[model samples]
Target chain A: MLKAIQNLGSSTTTTTRTTTGFVASFYRLKPPHATTTSAFVSISSSLLSYYSPRTRPTKPLLFLTRKTLSLEPVRAHSTRSESKMDDTSSSSSVAVQSSGSVRKINFCQWCGGQTKHDIPDGEEKMRAICTVCGKITYQNPKMVVGCLIEHDNKVLLCKRNIQPSFGLWTLPAGYLEIGESAAEGAIRETWEEAHAEVEVVSPFAHLDIPLIGQTYIIFLAKLRKPHFSPGPESLECQLFSLDDIPFDSLAFSSMAVTLKLYIEDVKAGSRKFHYGTINKRPGTSPSDTHGYTLVNHLQS
Target chain B: MLKAIQNLGSSTTTTTRTTTGFVASFYRLKPPHATTTSAFVSISSSLLSYYSPRTRPTKPLLFLTRKTLSLEPVRAHSTRSESKMDDTSSSSSVAVQSSGSVRKINFCQWCGGQTKHDIPDGEEKMRAICTVCGKITYQNPKMVVGCLIEHDNKVLLCKRNIQPSFGLWTLPAGYLEIGESAAEGAIRETWEEAHAEVEVVSPFAHLDIPLIGQTYIIFLAKLRKPHFSPGPESLECQLFSLDDIPFDSLAFSSMAVTLKLYIEDVKAGSRKFHYGTINKRPGTSPSDTHGYTLVNHLQS
Candidate 1:
């Protein structure tokens, strides 16, 4: 998709790195540094020119319009369902289930389903307590960053020092800082976790994993310097070839999908771009690593 | 631009309504829809495939990257000294100024410099609190929406419902809702303000009047149905011919820009999409009009 967009007669280019792959080409685009950027202004104005003739005073043309692109009613995805909570006027009720049990049980962890549990310990309980609002406030996920860095045809990998995956190898990624754009956050994470100066490439992968309460956007990037030392939060940071990727040691199932996608891009050659999971059929793997999961090969 | 994009081929039509002058007749391809959208996806993808095979896979394509897009810098019209407020943390200070004969000056609205008289009342102070983080918030200009609706070779427009031009003519446009997509909101505004069921023909106009705290995107739309009844908000909604556009009664200077753009698009026989101000040039109109406020163009 990056290649296709680039080939649209646009003079725009990435300034971050000099990678040839479309995914790796984002590094060449100049960073937004000054409050007023001359280069950005010029490109934007030129791109606008591409649309200028259309708005010029002349004969009007017939246009096609639709309420919906497709007649098919979209089935609700888990992420869509989760986002709905944010849209409601106020937080709404959500039934909590422990594990996979279907029993109707809503007792507080601090205090079981008893009247005493509702009483405050020292200060009087606030009369304006809304349980639904409380639940939503407690469960909102922070924005997280994920990246794939390349060096000498090998991809960089790191083992997270935190739990959920204390030892499994993963991409050099982390949460975003306040007031920073996603791309900037991704680069900052690459630096902090991998201790490497890397150029961010095109945004190639987006995965919304509702089960784990996370939305991961995996970017393809190029390492400015291949030599990187692991930061304190990383158990280790190292490069691995496609064949040598530690599939068994992968942390989240999403990482497997990310890797599988990178492999497909490698195989599809230059024109390989969008791998949108928007229309993935139901019952399919949320990660969509159908034939590529390590467990699948291990089981066979 | 859209016609050029649509009729990339088709040698038969030379300078027809659908023909963008610069496009190649050989590239014309019929769209699956009544209007051709073939170039939007397929042609671009095919173009990406034409990249030179020998091009290094690791080198960045400058045009495709953001760094190379040249956008203009914001020119400062004010002669005030360049001073930045360093208050990301928690300190507050007061600054006073004496203007000529007036010794008791007020607050500096642009820099958050407060004056003794600027001290806030409890409720007014509360109003300034940021809802997102519960802190005093800086003022920001609100966003507005605008639209161009076409019917019977004429375009639909509305008279201003508010000041600075209490009753000037302009396209039916307004502010965007919190979470609305730019295009979606533009369409919705047309329906609400004009009582017209219209299809968005092509996006071709924009205006960003930061001095007055406004940013707007104007779209050209095909009137889906001529039968429309003015909604409660609109004083009147009607069509105006190209030759009969009420130039003197046009709402804001930006509205004049949209009208001029629409006229140019008709002459150019295509859509001209743009960002920032509708006219690309700086100060195209000296002493531009500020208040032709078109409000609530789109509902969430």
Candidate 2:
């Protein structure tokens, strides 16, 4: 099994096997639905340790769960048993992320049809056009909604227990789900990561990270009370004042930007809605330093 | 071909044929990527006219494009030529829209593998689990970002040329895409629908409609110049003050809510950030009577 995993022809295939093993290894790692890159790195590290000769370069993404899953399985299986194994391990890898997949939508999830990247009659740009059914799959930006909860003039932060940036402080946020409003999604993320109930004050920040195709909607909220602990995604949930907030250790640039904005808002005594773009900082990974530079647009 | 179009086993299949005919009939209808139900209705009315004997009901959706593209054609073609066509026509119909497809991930887009809807060990709910690769797929909410441009106390409104509410008024908006910020998307929509350039002032509204799995992020902006015209998506572009606002002729609940809120904010002299949900009206088809009720959470 490990040999098969090791010999996985493409990185996409390797990642696929790594993810399936991680998913099948234990559900306690985190629900596969909300699996993070941190989980991938952790599981990948273990899987890599099992094989020394070939260390498949790990992708800094956990997009498997997003681009996978089929509603028509009999066809999926029949195709798999036929000639699809090579293609499935490869083609499905492009444009699959929580931040929303873009470009090279090569397969028709509807008809198992191969697609040609062509500009349909009136479109200015090329799209993955299914040869059989002529369907165009579009991947758009995903919203990461979260809360910057304040109680006693301090902000609530969760130390991430999972990968990409494990053991680092961050706001409680996740991809917005169906049947829930953005505010509802924010509240759910707070509860899931920090075990806290919060009353949203107003929209605090609308930070766009175009590089990764995500918009961070961070709400400024107040704790309902003082009651809190940690949920599955957190190692610890703590309240920190501006003086003590771990600016250097926040898991994401979005979190750091939100906290700094909160502090600035507090000091200025004038609360305004903040909207801006976050560009990656130079000479560093997205996790290094504060990780991003905030370029605010002129306020109305 | 007509019989095949008529006997398309599922409404999903019916819709698929209708869409293909519509798409193939003319790309001038609107680019399939940004297609709306108005196009569906226009085309379906023509399609339904052709087959009078069997009045297959038309769905009030244009979801075929978002769920139908495939990257692996060899597998897709192989699967479709076999038993997959019936399944594809039926299965690909669920959980797809501009507002984002949700529920029922049954086939692995990666492996053409069959999936079972199971609650993998620790999940709170059942998720589609791939029987072949053990991978899961998740669907989340989509965002409709637009601009609410105000100049001389009048807002720029576009008379929609597309369906569900053709000839009705609305703010210029569309699905947020992969490479831009919400504000940038709003700007692009404004240009596409109204042929106008505007400068964003601030994030205005983040309205959520859980029923449709969509969030609208509207920005308050001012037209850059006096220049304005109608784009393909609009029949006409006009500036309307609160008095002349066509509240009854608006296209969507989200547009109505945002306009009304703008009126309210003008009267109050406080342009506070609005965060709320717009639930469908009790007796309307989401297009009548301004189509929805706005329930705002207490402002922060």
Candidate 3:
């Protein structure tokens, strides 16, 4: 595992196996030009001590590989995972603070021109307008696709290896990529997170978590085979009966509500589908007791 | 109606009543400093003639207000409406061309700093990275919410007064706002376009049009009263029996399929809810016969 971390570095500086049998891989931080020398040194020292062998045993090992690092900055897993591993929560705090500001463009990617923020003629909202190339940039909500996989009277749950809910169980889901249908995205996320093939039955839940700027489209799917294992983003993948579900440790409130709805419907013997919205109050942790409110319930 | 158009201009520059008695209001083009002279002249000439009274009779009267301009650049409605009113299609063509390019930020909206476009350290895709503020900007899909309103054995339809499918019939719908539930957005749109309140019964159809980067959530709804008329975004609102339904003139393929499903289910005495996706092939008009394919179906 230490060798894997060494490979992640562009050029490895040192590698050592500690007395505790944990590998310590150290690489020089390639700070961007804008990073101050003092800031770089401070960040590096903190990172080093955080990854030292003494601190390794208690932390989840999911972030030790490059595959897990492929998740984007906007994802809940990325924010949560990094905050836990790093002793300082400054980075995660910065991300959270920036979420409130409008997404502004500083330089044009096409012409490298300075941009202005204004509502273009005939447009309603303010947009980033290129000062040189006259290009207009817009921001929209992202689609997060996942599945509620059911098999043999049990639902599949993966113990997340990354943050925002590291070590907590969740349905297999991730950000939808460009050029894919919602169903395809959901199936892909399931396979990527759980190493399981699924046959999507139907669209089960449409949740708009506007606070995170994501609209999660969850499908009710069936496991194609009984075999399953944890993928890079998951520490463990297992089938949990209703009685065994860990509601307290669910990764997201949306997942908890979805699972609860599914369980209750199953008990009633009338498994109707649901579509609605989930809103998390500002400044409240998603896992907070009063954090999220389900505003609408549409059942069929 | 002509008087309404005159009121739209900040300062009345030129207003002409044509032989058809339609008022053509032309405002001076206030191009941004970055816009090239030739581009401004070309865009203005086309826009002027498009809104001219001679061309007004054939088009839907949707673009007669500032509220409609609040629609974003990502929507098919914006592209279609602009092209129809502009006459030359050059503006629409320019928008289509820009769609393929990355959304660039030239000046950071937060700190007025330079920005770069590159795949961020841990992400799979390229994004705008602010140099001064260290902000990462991301683009995502937009949600379009609407309703399938039924009353007294008749389905309500609105003749769109806006562009894209101007003059064509459609269920009342619009872009989902920043802080609203999908059901709230759908109900609001129905009221805004048809002057009728509706109780959203359940989720009816979930269609993902990856080509336009939209996820449309349609609901089964009930009209609160027998009274409705054309709202600002609609030219005519009426209830059509199954035999009188206008399939060929429906505004969107997803709407057509949803209506068809509703009709078929009603005839079978099983108004089961449907969940599925609709994918449109690239470069094909949405109205094209082979443009859209429904991938999966889940009924209850």
Give all candidates' CA lDDT scores: 0.37, 0.53, 0.53
Instruction: Give the per-residue lDDT digits (tens) of candidate 3, residues B187-236.
Output: 76677788776766667777665444466778877866578888866899
Residue A58 CA error for candidate 1 (Å)? Answer: 40
Write one digit per residue (lDDT tens) for candidate 2, span B1-300: 011122101113122333111110111233223333542322212111112221122111212221112111111222111110001111133224322232334355556576675545533434445678675554556778888988898999988675546677888888776545676667766776777767666667777765556788888877766888998768999999889999878877778778777787789886766676654432344356343445433232
True contacts kept of each: 0.00, 0.35, 0.27
Minimum summed lDDT over a 10-residue window in model 2 chain B is located at B79-88
Listed in order, the DockQ scores are 0.02, 0.16, 0.12
Cα lDDT of model 1 by residue, A189-281, tens digit: 676678776655444453433222233545566766556878766789989998899876776555766776677567766312222111112
* Error in Å for residue B292 of model 2: 2.2
Two-chain complex of model 1, DockQ on C-alpha atoms against the true structure: 0.02
Interface RMSD, every prediction, one decimal place = 19.9, 16.8, 17.9
TM-score of each candidate structure, all chains considered together: 0.33, 0.67, 0.65
- Alpha-carbon runs more than 4 Å astray in model 1: A1-143, A210-213, A278-300, B1-300
Identify the runs in model 2 with alpha carbons over 4 angstroms from their true place: A1-95, A98-104, A298-300, B1-95, B98-104, B121-123, B298-300
Q: How displaced is residue A298 in candidate 3, in Å? A: 1.9
Q: Give candidate 2's error at residue B158 in angstroms.
A: 0.9
Using DockQ as the measure, the top candidate is 2
Reference-based lDDT, residue B30, model 3 = 32
The runs of at least 3 residues in candidate 3 whose Cα sits more than 4 Å from the true structure, single-residue gaps closed, are A1-137, A210-212, A281-283, A289-291, B1-118, B126-134
